[model samples]
Target chain A: MHIPDGFLNIPVSAGAAALSIGAVSLAVKKVQKTIEDRLVPLMGVLAAFIFAAQMFNFPVAGGTSGHLLGGMLAVVVVGPWAAMIVLTCVLIVQCLLFQDGGLLALGANVLNMAVIGVLCGWVAKKATNFLSRTAAIFIGSWISVVAAAAAAAAEMAISDTAPFATVLVAMVSVHAIIGTGEGVITILVVSFLKRVKPEIVEDGACRAL
Target chain B: MKNRKFIVFSLLACAAVVVFAAVFASSYPDGLEQVASKMGFENKMSGINLMGAPMPDYGLALFGAGPFSTLVAGLSGLAAVFLATTASGWAIKRLRRSGNG
Candidate 1:
């Protein structure tokens, strides 16, 4: 869920931006511990994979397409700190080069997509791991994307972009379906990595924070 | 020392994936745009005129009806990754030296 420009007010966006800066700072530091020998290259490949995955957008509803957000993917594959850096990089590229998002609102978008998305996904995975792998995947994927969407909606609502209820309903409803796709994709990809490259999954490569 | 290989490997892999991503990126509106279209809120969204641009879609100005635009978008994303990661790395290094990290 890439948030375009004008969705958030200056104050809310700025506040979120500040918080994002702090979170990213923390992430960078945390990643330093595990970002070396095995994790860095894996993180790079994972970033590329996430970037590539984002390109394959499947149609959702109302003529819109949803792709893998990869917040959960990054967290499960790498770790939260590295995921933060990876996602921030991805969002920045989308905004600056592709012109997919607004420059002014990059911070807010990164906060929602990078920081909140990864953490929520990680928490959900941790919470649901006691269940079946499918359940864990579903819960992780669903919660992560929803959290990002809700954060985006909350930013919009706080910024007065749209009515809070309208934004919430629209953002959350569509993303719920999108989350299913995300969950499925994440689970499948993770499973694949586990099978083909067990080291990436087991070693926890690129873990910063 | 041990982590250096991982960092280098990840960076190179990201570069390779970016190439493929650019070549095959779906030409579909994402979540926000989709919501706007379906909910009829697209008109409410305003556009900006950065660099005297005409067509709003990224493909218009950069590539203009060709794969080059997509390629450039993907490469541009790589550029962003370089800049963002470099900056983040520097920021962390500085913070650590300052005894804050």
Candidate 2:
């Protein structure tokens, strides 16, 4: 979710921005340390795909719509570090070019999706691989969306944009359904990639499918 | 599939989504927006975009709000994201090379 400016006060926004900057910088370093040759163009296409996928907001329930956040999807293709960079770039482009997100809240959005979302998804995938490959990716992806929404809700609540309990409940509940859609999309794409180009789906999770 | 072919396929998929979104993206407010509206804090969104993006909400302001405008804007965004990430990846790889050398 791209947070708007007024949702957070200056301090919270700045704090999130600082943390986001650190995370992005670390991501850059990690990618530099060891990046695969194929990943160069692969990252390009994945970024484009994620950006495009976010455009179609399918209606969910109660007059709410949801779109593919793509953090977990990107992570399944690339590792967490590169996924962060990819997501940060997407968020930045959305804010600067499309104005989809508030410029002042860019850092917070990046923190929520690029940093927290990717890592949570990666951890979930890694932990649950024993269950089944597809299941792990699905569960991991669902968690990523919920984690990002939770983080966003926490930020707004802390900012007094809304009541903490209610914001958390509302955001989480809506996103839980949205996250399933995310999982389905992720599974569809990852499965397609795994079938088409087995090596490309690094998955970064243990166990082979 | 070759890496080259896969790249082409994915790019085509990206373009397909953009065009699809141009024609049929849902207008409903998303989860956060829905929550904000229900909670009566949607007004909290200042909606002040510091950087006036040429294409706000995937439609070019210069052009009338139409499917074609969205198609143009979406393609532009897809290209922008593709190039930005590609450049970043290249820069990182180059830096790594020089560091190791």
Find the candidate with the highest lDDT and give its number: 2
Distance from true location, Cα of B37 in model 2, Å: 0.4
Error of 1 at B59 (Å): 3.1
lDDT for each residue of candidate 1 in A1-209, tens digit (9 for 90 to 100): 77666666679868988999999878887875444444444555566567656766777766677889899888877777788988888776666655556666778888998999889988888888888766876798889998999898888788866778888898998899899999888888778667655566653444332
Note the DockQ of each predicted structure. 0.34, 0.79
In model 2, where do residues sit more than 4 Å from their true spots? A202-209
Cα lDDT tens digits for candidate 2, A1-209: 78877899898899999999999988888787668677889888989999999998888988888999999888877778889999998999999998888999999999999999999998999899999989999999999999999999999999989999999999999999999999999999888888888776865431121
TM-score of each candidate structure, all chains considered together:
0.82, 0.96
User: Residue A87 lDDT in model 1?
Assistant: 87
- In the range B1-101, model 1's lDDT, one tens digit per residue, is 23466556555655665566556656677777776676676665556634332333445564676566655655555555555655655555566567765
The candidate maximizing TM-score is 2
Docking class of 1: acceptable
Docking class of 2: medium
Give interface RMSD, per candidate: 4.4, 1.4
lDDT of every predicted structure (CA atoms)? 0.71, 0.89
Determine the iRMS, in angstroms, of model 2: 1.4
In candidate 1 the C-alpha lDDT for residue A121 amounts to: 87
